[model samples]
Each structure stands twice: as C-alpha cells, then as structure tokens.
Target: MSVTRVELAGRSYEVRVGSGLLEDVAVQCGPLLRKQAVPIITDANVAAYWQEAVTGSLTAAGFEPHFLVLDPGEATKSWQVLEQVVDWLLDQEVERGDHILALGGGVIGDLTGFAAAILKRGCGFIQLPTTLLAQVDSSVGGKTAINTRAGKNLVGAFHQPSLVLADLDALATLPSREMGAGYAEVIKYGILGDHAFFAWCEENGAKVVAGDAAAQEYAVDQSVAAKARIVAQDERETTGTRALLNLGHTFGHALEAETGFSDRLLHGEAVALGMVLAARFSARKGYISQDDAARICAAIGNALLTTEIASLDLSCRGADLVAHMLHDKKMDAGTLPFILLRGIGEAFVDKHVDLAEVGAFLDEELAR
Candidate 1:
C-alpha cells in the first residue's frame, strides 16, 4: 500500500492506497478509534458488496460498527437525505469526537462527509473511497457537500478526514461505464496543472483503464499527490490557487444543471466535456494555439473522456447551456468566472471574462 498525507493547519489525514485496505481498516483506525464506536454510512448497493467485510474488520478491532443504509443515487445526496443521515447518527448516539466512516463511491462519500461535518457541530470521519474518482480526488480534499436546487455542491463544508483508504480491489467491481466516469478525473489532474503526469497518463491510461494493477496504483498515487499539494496550499479555497482544480467544473456543473443533475450527465463526464470546452475556449481566446488545444483533446481522447462526454447527443444548444450557468457558484455580481488555459498544464481563473462572450462561444461549439 502507498500511504500519503495531506498536511493542513490543524487538520491532517493519511490517504492509504492499495488492495484490500478495507480488511485493514480497523488497524488503520486503531489510533483514531480510541473508545470511539464507528458508524458506517453507505447505501444498499455498496452494502451488498462491502458490509460484511467492513463490519467484521471494525468489530474484530474492538470498534463497534453501526450502519445507516440509505437509498441509492444522486437524488440521495440531498438535504432530505442528509436529514435522514443526521437523524440516524443521532439514533446511533454518535458523539462529536467519534468518527463516521463514509463507505462507498463519491455520492456516499460526499453525503456522509457533509453529514459528518455538520453532525454535533463538526465531528470526525474517514473516507473508504471505493471508486477511482473518489480515491484520487473527492475523498482527500475535505470538500464535503450536498447539491442544492441552485447547483451541484452549493451546500457544503471543508471537513478533512482522519484517514482515507483507497482500496484498488474495490474498483474491480465497478461497471465499465462507471470506470470510464472515474478515468475522467484522473485525466483531469494531468490536464489541469501537471504536464509530466499528463504525458504519463497518455502513455499508460489505456492500461490503467484496463485495470492493470501497476497502472491503477500509479494513477491513484499521482492524482492524490497532485490534489494534496493543491489542498495543502489552499485548504479552504480561500485563495484562487486551489480554484484551479475547478478546471472543467464550471462548464461541467453548468452541464449538470442543464441536465437536472440526473443520469443524463455524470459529474466526471461533465468534467470531461467541460475540460474539452475549456481547452477549446482557451484556443478561441488566443491564449493557447490550436495545436496545444489539439494535444489536450488528444490526451483526453486517449483516456476516453471526450467520447464519454460526447455520449450525450449534440442536442442541447450552447445558449441553453449558458442558461444553466446562471446559478453557478463562481458567478459574482452577475458575471461568471471561468478556469481557462493558456496551454497544456497551465490553468488560470478568468474573472474579467464577459458572460456574453462565453455564451457566444458556447453557441459556436453547439452549432458545430
């Protein structure tokens, strides 16, 4: 297992990556467990695959394991669902110092992390990220959130975990489509700011996508390291430095809103398309030449992100897409800022951008 750390002000955590981390979770939590009983928050789908193994491990290590099995899907990451989870934790008598285990994909990790952040006015939690995206991105940053009617992750907090266990074995069971969804984020780290890793992904992304062990481990470790560096520099996103991580998020989140945040558009898929749009937009702005944009798209293409985002028919017009951006969190004083690139591995936030200009650009992309 490759263990890494995200060191922050008063909040730091270990992110352990490899196979069967679930089996060793109890021992991993030994130092944090203290007399703290462990409450596992997962949904029916994940419970089917991991409940028995996780419970046995936690129990054998002398930590009482109580669970809150929730309804599955993006709809479950809502205020109503969060209320249910909070109520369940209360029923389990979870205390402020005690830790909760978020045991599932991004949805479960996100929902549980938000719940853990607010429960008892911010308690402790752990991330047992089972999906590739969660392992590399969402689980480590402590950006816990629940989607609001405004947009994705509108209601959330910065609550770091005590430990994060990314079990590569868990990815074996993910559906191919979901696997593709995750590969988008892995490609994102490379695209957003890491030129060398981006090149590495271009070379080995197919093998990683095929579930090659070494390839998978390298992807996770490198992605986590990239994210950790960003998180360490800007933990709460108070500075624009961390905002670079939103490379494709602005466009992606708008796409998610346009689709109503349903199965029509998965977050990572939206990100994939969003990155393409960002790269293309950068070229349009003359910040990056056409060749650089082509290279970025080629790398994303090799990783299968462009096709996944393109999976959605070219039905929604760009004007329609811009309408969805109306609720974007990055907007301030009626203008939406975007993370555009000057070239590969280079990203900068463009706050002075005119919304009407982006709208015009979206029109052009949709027309093509």
Candidate 2:
C-alpha cells in the first residue's frame, strides 16, 4: 500500500493505491464524501466487472447509492454523454456539495468530473479508478474533459476530486491489451522526468503488467507523486510542466482522430507509438543520440506494445497527421508546441517547432 497527497489551493486529497482498497473505501472516503448524495458513474464495461463490490460498499455504509453507466469508449466522451450524465444527476438530485464517483478508466473519469464540475456550477467528486491508466494519471489530476469533433479532450474543466480511490484489485478485470495501453502512461512518468523511475519501469514494468501487487503499488504511488507535484505548482498548466505530460499524446491523438476514435487505436497505444516517434524525431533533430532512441523503443517493446509503427504503412501521411495536431487543445497562437526529448529521462516543451519539419519526419516514419 502506498499513499501520496496532491495539494492545491483550496482542494487537496490523497491518492490511496493498493490491493483491497475498495473494501476500505467507505472508511477511507467517509470524511471526503461528507455523507452527501453521492452518485457512482461508470461505463458498462467496468460496471460489469466492479458494480457489485462498489455498490455493496456504499450500501453497507447506509448511504443511498445511484449509478450512471455509460457505454465505454472515446466516442462516449462527448457532449451527448455529458447531457445524459447531467440528467442522471438531476434525477438523483445531486448538489454542489455532493460527491460523484467516477468508476472506470480515463473516459469515465473525464466525463464524470466534467459533470460534477458543471452541475450547479461545481459539485464534489471522488475517483474510483479501476484501470492502471486512471489509477496513475487521469484519476489524480484536476484535468477533466470530453472530446469533440474538433479533437480529443477539446471540452473540459479543472475540477479536482475530493478523494481518489485507486484499487489495484479492480485491475484484475482488465483485458491484456487495455493493461498495455495503461502501462504506456505509467512509463510516461519516467520518460518525462524521473530517470531512476524510468529504469525501474524497464526492470519491473513486466511485474506490473503481470499484476504483481508490490509493483502495482509502487507504479501508482510514484506516478501519482510525480504528477501531483507538477499539478501543485501549475494547476491550470500555466507553466509548461504539465504539457510535458502530453509527451507522446499530440501525435497519438491525431492517429486516434484519423481512425475516427475507434478501437483500432486505443489512447495508450497511441501514446506508446507517439513516444517512440517523439524520441526518433528528437534524434533526427540531433538532440538525442539514435542509440538513446533505440533504448526507448526497446523499453516500449518490453512492455509488449506493437511498436512496428514503421511497418504499419499507415494510410495517412505525416502532413495529414500534422493537420490533426492543429486541433490539439493545447495549441496556442497558431503554433503547436511539441513535447520533445533530449534523452530517455528528459522531456521538454518546444514551442517554436516548425510543423513542416514534423510533417516531413512523420512522412519518413510512415514510409518506413
């Protein structure tokens, strides 16, 4: 068991990650929920896997439990889903002070957090992250969002969770592919800043992917601690620190968008490939050695991601992909700053990057 605290201006909370935390949820979250009308919002997939134990805990504690279950996927992270969740909250009579439980992966957390943020102008919420991705990244940060026709996470808020319940037991139900996707984000913490942790991932990521308890706890604890520290200093992403977290995402999101945000490309896989390309591109820019880039790709392969992106012969060109990045939510003043790296453990935001150069590089990768 490992616990890390994320402190912000008015809202600060602890991210408790470990096995059997779900059973202790009521005890741990009692003060956080404040005994109000708390609603548990999940998707159909997670509901099938975790609905019983979660509702059982709430029911045992003598609190009324209402559920809002969405169809799971990036497609569900839309304005339509937002409307449906808001209606469910209205039916439950959820208030500004009440808590909404986001009980799935990133998609569920983002939609539910946005709902809580806008419900009567900001309701409280708790995070019950069931997937590794949610447990480490989405569940802790105040960054909540819904995707749009323009791009992913185009509409959202910065409403933080009152309590984040990261139960490793919930991960037992994850599909192996889904686990790999989430692991991509787990590796991201190391790539962005922490060299020692990056080395640890190279060594123990296999243990985590195999669902080892201690490795799972450490991955969640360290990842959350890294993100919490960044969020604390720059909650709204005022500085470029939070943007570094998007390391591989800009290119990955474009791949997702081109595929119409379907199962053909999961978020984590996109990040996995995107990070590979980012490293490759950095090597092309002479910032990092090709050997360093190869090591990054080797680490990604050890996690079992299909990094034969070179062999994919993707239907889209680098120029086409660059166009998709234009829709990125983080773009500013007509220039899209990229999160590039000089080496494995060092990531930086480069604002003046020329898109044509990025397009040429993508074109080369796609051809390979």
Candidate 3:
C-alpha cells in the first residue's frame, strides 16, 4: 500500500492506494466514524458489485450500514438527484461531525460530497473511489460538483474528503472502454507538467490499462501526489497555479456540451481529444512546433482514443461549439481562459483568447 497526503494545514488528509482496501474498509474508516450507523451513498452499478463486501465488513465491525443506491450516469449529478441525496442524508440523522462514505466513481463521489458539504452546513465525508478516473483525479481534489443545464460541474463546492481510499482491485471489473476513459486522466498529469512522467506514460500506458499491478500502483500514487501538491498550494483556486489542472477541460467541456453530455463522449475521452486540440492549437499559435503537436496526438491515438473532432460526426459548426464556452465556469470578465500547451509537459493559461479566432481554428479542426 502506498499513501499520498494532501497537505492542507489543519485539513490535511491521506489518500491510500492499494489492493484489498475495500475488503478492509471497516478497519480503515473505523477512526472516522462517530457512531454505529454509517451512511453510504453509491450508484446502483457499484452497489451491484461492491455492496456485499462493504456491508459485510461494516457489519462485522458492529456498525449498522445504511445505503442509498442511486441510478448510475452523468445525469445523476443533477439538481433533482442532489435534492434526493440531501434528503436521504438528513433522514440518516447525520450530523456535522459524522463522516459519510462515497463508495463509487466520480458521480457518486461528487454527489455524496456535495450532500456532505451542505448537510448541517458541512459534515465530513470519505472517498472510496472505485474508478481509475476518480482515484487519479477527482477523489483527491475536493472539487465536488453536479452538472447543470448550463454546463458540467457548474454547481459545486470545494469540499475535501476526510480520507480517500483508492482500491486497485476495483479496476479488474471495469469495462475496456471505461479503462480507456480513465487512462485519459492518468495521462493528463503528465501533459500538464511533468515531461519525464509523460514519457513514462507513453511507454507504460498500455501496461497500466492492461491491469498490471505495479504499473497501476505507480500511476495512481504519482498522479495523487502531483495533485496533492497542487491542491495544497491553491485549495480554492485563488491563484492561477491550480488552474493548470484543467489542461484540457475547457475544450473537453465544450465537446461534452455538443454531445448532450452523454456516453457518446466520456469526460476522459473528450479530454484525450481536447488535449490533442489544445496541442494542435498551440502549434497554430506558434507556441509549439507541429511535430510536438503530432507527438501529443500520436501518444493519445496509441492509447486507442480518438484524436480528431472530425470523427465525432457533429452537425454543428465550430462557432456553435465556441458558443458553448460562453457558459464555462472558468470564464472571467467575459474572457474565457484556455489551458494551452507551450510544449510537451508545459501548459499555461491564456486568458486573452479571442473567441472569433478560436472559432475559426476550431472550424478548420472540425472539417479536418
């Protein structure tokens, strides 16, 4: 087992990554429970596979486990579902000091964490992230949010989990498409900052996705540590330092909106293509060489992710896609900042981007 700590002064927490963590969850979370009843929120898909182990563990520890199984999908992160989760937590008689367990992927974690944040004006919650995307990115960042009609993650809070347990065993059950979706986030840490790690990913990404134990552990540990360092520095995103984490999110979110935020483009897949777009756009702006942009696309394509927007068969024009950015949460003072690459492993925020120019550039990409 490897542990990475998110150093947030008095709010510091540990993210433990390993196998069998779920089977031993009761002992792991024992110190955080305030009473016998433990309230857990998860999606129906996760409950189908994991509810038995978690229930048995908590029951064996003499704790009464109560679960609220929600329907699975991105749609679950809506106002209606948020209200349901809050009401369920309220009925659980949860208090400000008690910890609620979020036992699923990003959707469950985001909804449950948001519920914990608003419950009694802020309670504690632990993240039991069961997906690769959650473990490597969402589970540790304390950015809990639900998707709204306007945009993805537009309504949310910076509610940190008290502890995060990322169990590698869960990946064994993931579908291949889901594994590829998660790999996009894993490669993101490299694209945004670390050149050496990017190279490592270029070589070992296949191994990591193929369920190699050592590669998975190293990838999860390194990704968590990198995020912990950034989150500790800028917990609220007050400084631009933390904004670098959204390397491909702006473009990715726009693609998501165009696709109706459905399974047609998973968040990570959009990110994979977005990173390619960001790299190519950077080259167009004379920031990076075309070869570097091609390198980025090749790496993504090697992972079996689509690297071109042209492949999406979108009926909308690039201007229509740019219109989607108008509602982006990152838009500041009517100018949306984009995370563009200067080179491999070098990303910077460009806040003065002209929407018209972006639209034109995207128009070319759409037709390419």
Error of 3 at 343 (Å): 1.0
Give the better candidate number (1 or 2) by TM-score.
Answer: 2
Assess candidate 1 and give its lDDT: 0.84
lDDT, each prediction: 0.84, 0.86, 0.92
Single out the weakest 10-residue window by summed lDDT for candidate 2: 306-315
Cα RMSD, model 2? 1.3
Model 2 TM? 0.97
Could you give candidate 2's per-residue lDDT for residues 148-216 as a string of tens digits? 998999889999998888988888889888888999999998988988999999999878888787888
lDDT digits (tens) for residues 214-253 of candidate 3 = 8988999889999999999999988987999898888899
Clash pairs (backbone) in predicted model 2: none
> Across residues 1-368, which tens digit of lDDT does each residue of candidate 1 receive?
88888988777888998888888888877777756467899989888899999988888877778888888778888999999999998998888888888999899999999998899898899899888888888998899989988888889888888899999999887876677778888988887798888889889887777788889999999999989999999997778889999988888888888778898777778887888889988999999999888887787677666533345665676677778787787777887778999878889989877767888888777656
In terms of TM-score, which candidate is strongest?
3
Off-target runs (Cα >4 Å) in candidate 2 are: 34-37, 310-313
Worst 10 residues of 3 by lDDT: 173-182
- Candidate 3, superposed: residue stretches over 4 Å from native: none
